[model samples]
Target: MHIPDGYLSPQTAGGLWALMVPVWYAAGYKVKKTLSARQAPLVAIAAAFSFVIMMFNLPLPGGTTGHAVGGTIIAIIIGPWAAVIAISVSLTIQALFFGDGGILALGANCFNIGFVLPVTGYYTYRLLSRGAAEDSPRRWFAAGIGAYVGLNLAALITAVEFGLQGDLFKAADGSALYSPYGLSTAIPAMMIPHMAVVGVIEAVMTSLIFVFLLRNNPSLLHSYDGIRAAATGRLQLKPLLIGMALLLVCVPLGLLATGSAWGEWGAEEIQADVGYVPQGMDRYLGRWSGILPDYAFPAAEEADTGEEPAGAVSLEGVKESVPGYMVSGVVGLALVGGLAWFSTRLLTRRSRKKEQLD
Candidate 1:
């Protein structure tokens, strides 16, 4: 779930950043030490997958929409450290470029999806898959179960973040200054769809992908140096590239999703739904104008014709939104994949230099 701006107090967001900075640093160090040339491309591909997978939003029964983070699958395929970096990069791009998540809330979003999801999912997978053969059905079951649990846990953490804003911050009139929903409202609103639907999707995706890799290119799967590697041989990129191409073709499905996330509504939308917008939210929300708000280009023709504002494009049933989303997906994948690949190349060079010195 992407918490938009004005959903969390500055204190909450800042605190999450303080917590995440060290985690990010540690993960980077670990990745530098463990990532090999053969594994680097896998990380880049996984990063691209993480970037693109979020484009396929699924409408929930309750009128809202959700999507799998792909964090657990990445963690199972690579390692948790690399998963953290990949997801953090993807979330940052979504926030800074696409306005999918709040810029101020980037830390919280990364913590939830990047850190919490992967670490929890990876550990759960290890625990359940232990003592089982690499290609055994038990390993697949473990991946599914781990993904289900990990996604739900991330949802729970997100609910707590929203709930805390209500509990800890309020206006002079007792109106919530940040997120209006308390624990009672936030927990159910976030948990239901994630646990019942989103988690299932995550589980199935993780298991299926893991199974495919095991059958076709098991060597590409990171074993955490035998701790988690499923199969061993040489790295393969064809399957991953093919999977990404298929996902890119399906990016437009996200536009078909019905409603926004529970806590991601803008101030005006919140007012329309609840009859009163939180004063703090109304004042602070729209702090940043992204290059592509909601992955749609500004309808310049509509603006020139006085049909709508320059940046206003209806999210519902718009034929033009498809091309815009497709472009966003492809561009995001390229940026993230290139960054990951470059970073790994640098790391590989440094490692080689160190070995020479030794």
Candidate 2:
């Protein structure tokens, strides 16, 4: 689901940024208004959960793989506005540090996963679970259904983003300049796996977590059903910490899945597979390099011999080693978790100061 650099034209990427800036601002304002000191830790933990969950990629029927974003779950647990901040933070770290996503396409990526998925999923869950109690089976079922539908919608939007590039940007010979595949190819290639396997994973994950939280620590679910657990001055952090630890343990499962995503291929791989790389992709995709490109560190031998490292794995047509993937996951978790925690703490302090003045 991480659209690497060069997949989108400058216009498309810029357009997405323009669309998202105001959305991000509004989310920040809304979150600031509603966020309490007690809920600060919840936002951070939810962000960490979103960060780690995206690491577990599920293999699809085709040679490609996708992961559950956990956006909707975060939205349901926290508010959609807060989910926006959490997911955007995670995606920003992945793009800037790990190179999991394109730098230029960060706006598009955040818009898809951070904005579209959470907002849509949150609303869907609310609509379906409206009359039901938070602990009701119907509410859980609604969460599952909402997650499934929300993830697919995000996938569909991503497909359209890719498809539009083909029509809007092309070479003199009518060849695509950025993403080569039109809607006919992009939609099916991206949506099938989500509609089948990935969606189910997201649905199950959301429902199970919702149930677990509801049973053990209903206070953590303050965002749902307008419940104010903080009124008691006791916040349950143990369950969330335990869940985060478990997710860390399961991070390796992402490596077990083989094949790259449908449209995230590198320039060399795209050219070899399609006989020619799209001009825009070839030009802009490799423009920026991250500390760990493809989550792989070049071997010391490569520095000495000036040759490609032997530790490279060709899973996504990139030389990403297993150790590199593990390191990237750990580092990403720390950075994202730290940022979320720090930001929420600051927001809480400011909110407190404002209340004192009031």
Candidate 3:
């Protein structure tokens, strides 16, 4: 649930930013407390997974399409803080390079999908899996349900934000506005079913990835395995079959997202809410808002469906969001990998010099 620009007032947008800073700090602090050595590689891998999965959009029966949020999966693998960082980085890449989302709304998007989804999803999973054994059917079931529900909750919050900012459902008399598909209808119409389908996708994907990492690399699951394994049994292959079924559903959905089907379905519902449905929306669709609970500027075009014009926000204009994505991948590798190698060699030479001294 991305909040398109124009949905939020400047005051509301700024207030959200003020609130988000503290939350981001808290998330990072928690990550520092929980991080471990083996977890580092897994963090990088999870970031990569988030990047790739979002690329494949699924079509819905409705004209609109949806894709996996990856928030729950990342949270399951690397605590919610790290998940936020990962998703934020991935989103920056998508927006800057691909022009999928608006530059003005990156922070909003980060807070919604990155912070809201994962933080909420993590605690929810814990609450649901409270008493299950490791690999127990109960734990798995709890995890899936928790993930599914968490996404919907986040989506609902996002819808409300839209309603507040854009007058999504206000009538002249201050009653619920009516539409062939107005904001009143769009809120539940778009959010409930869309989020439900997404929740299932998230749940199965989380379970599968959880199982995979558990069997092949238990260390990767270290953060929550203590709690999760205590509830379930151990990760196993049965979820693989479940994952496949979910994936099958996802494939057709992704095809539809990239195709015209998603547009026809989702557009009808969304269009009913707009004071004047901007043509730019046809391209921005899912990428319109930053994440949820905030406004991300919708992608803009001069004439509906073509390249953006000169005045539109561009990769160069949105430097805050891109630097980390463009440079961090290389710099992080160098500092984490190259520096380690160089430091080792320097230490070895010093030791050799000490031997000569001896």
Candidate 4:
């Protein structure tokens, strides 16, 4: 759902950017008010986790893939505004380094996934979990459902933005055109499959994590419900560690299961159900460039080992090149995790020493 450059008209992109300015400011203000000294470390960890999670795209049915943005996780730990900042930074890094998303499309992506999902999810969870115990099954369930709702909502927002862009500049009808990418189309295209399965997976994962925190370090979660406060328990590190281990082990199995199904379905389902057939935008879209020379396929030097062109992107290439991806995944995870831990330790230790001296 990361809108690439040229998918949106200049006007649409500019409009979103304008809207984002106030939102970003609001998010910053909220962060200043909400984030405490103790919660700071967790906030950094949330950002790092989000960054790492998105690197692995889960296969969908249409050859296109989706990744966990972890907006809900961030919202759960911090407020939505902080989630926006974290996601924005993570997305910016992804855009800059890997060319996963276009820099020109940054505002739109931030608005849709970062702002829309986390803000809405946090509020919705707050509403549903009202009066529920923090560690209760109900609160966890609400979080899961809230996350699902948030993801679908973000998808809907993206679809509408795309549809509007498709119509505003692509169609002769100056008014909004009736297309498959409309709200109706977007709802089913993005909601149906995600709700059925992805929602459940997210719910289970979120619940497990929530429960782990509840049983272990209750102080880690500042805003737990009233009932949870009653259960004054000592922090148990072993359960949390074991739970995390289980999650790590299960991630691959979940990825394989969802990835295969989603990869097969995404192409046909989206092309058919959410097809935004912009009749006259190809010429315009093709001419646009981004931070990368060409968003779709930026030119790159040859591998120098008698390898294929670096810029070439093909479905067959992906299918035939599973091993390369596996290796990349291993290497990328190690690099990201090492960087996150090292940076966190260095920064925190420096800050702590400064505080002690003061």
TM-score per candidate? 0.91, 0.91, 0.62, 0.68
lDDT of 2 by residue, 1-358 (tens): 7888789999999999899999988997887777765577778888888888888877778677789988887988778898999999999988888677888899999999999999898889889988887678987788888889889998999999998999999999999999998899899988988898999999999999888877876665644543254633667778788878887876766776666777887787788777899888888887765787655565621433334333333453333355676777778888898898777767667766755676
Candidate 4's TM-score: 0.68
The reply for model 3, stretches above 4 Å from the true place, is: 168-183, 223-256, 259-358
Model 4 clashing-pair count = 11
lDDT of 4 by residue, 26-88 (tens): 876665555433344445556656665564455554444566666775687656776787777
Estimate candidate 4's alpha-carbon lDDT, on a 0 to 1 scale. Answer: 0.56
lDDT of 2: 0.81
**Would you list the clashing residue pairs of candidate 2?**
none
Q: Is candidate 1 or candidate 4 better by lDDT?
A: 1
Q: What's the C-alpha lDDT at position 356 in model 4?
A: 60
Decreasing lDDT order of the candidates? 1, 2, 4, 3
RMSD of each: 3.5, 3.6, 11.2, 7.2
Ranked by TM-score, the better of candidates 2 and 3 is 2
Q: How many backbone clashes does candidate 1 have?
A: 2
Q: Report lDDT (Cα) of residue 299, candidate 2.
A: 63
lDDT of 1 by residue, 1-358 (tens): 8888888898999999899999999988888777655566778888889888888888887677899988887987778998998889888888888888888889999999999999999889889988987778888888889899999999999999999887799999888888888899999999998988999999999999888877876655555353224223456578789989999998887777756777888777788877788877776788885887788777732443335432344554456578778888888888889888776667667764654566
